[model samples]
Target: MPNDSPELNHEVTAPRAGTAREWELFVSEDATESPRHVGSVTAPTREAALERAELHVGRDAATLWLCPADEVTRRTAETAALSNR
Candidate 1:
């Protein structure tokens, strides 16, 4: 369970004028049957995000996915639904 915090200060101007940002975390296989989420300290670099993920996975080889913030929720839902069946 690592804390994921990314410091991004970028603004977007358009029809939906707002701040454009992303939070990076790692999706790794859990030691137990249950799924666990671990986040790293806020980093503005992709390298930092990948580093965080590697830390969680430890020495094991893993498939890492750098999903967008919006996709996070969707993917979670899909996983949950499939697992529940």
Candidate 2:
């Protein structure tokens, strides 16, 4: 059987007052295509993030996905090399 596993990284932190948290925006123009990372937004809350995303890119997207930047674990090629050591 194939291993059906989901990537897990659930750590989320609250944004401080007067500070904004980064949100990753993914949008799909149509149902046939997968959502692609378009850009990012800085907001104090999830609701604000969605609002900003909609204003900027959601108007033409069929679907939208907003992910907290803190929740994402990004690894660059250089970092990947170091991790393999």
TM-score of 2: 0.66
- Which portions of model 2 show Cα errors greater than 4 Å? 1-18, 78-85
User: lDDT per residue, candidate 2, 1-85, as tens digits?
Assistant: 6555554444335554348888999999999999999988999899999999999894799999999987977777776886576
C-alpha root-mean-square deviation, candidate 1: 9.6
Rate residue 5 of model 1 by lDDT.
45
- Model 2 worst lDDT window (10 residues): 3-12
Lowest summed lDDT across 10 adjacent residues in model 1 is found at 12-21
Q: Model 2, 7: alpha-carbon shift in Å?
A: 34
Candidate 2: lDDT over CA atoms? 0.84
Which regions of candidate 1 are displaced past 4 Å? 1-41, 75-85
Q: Compose the digit string of candidate 1's lDDT tens values, residues 41-64.
A: 334556765666677666653445
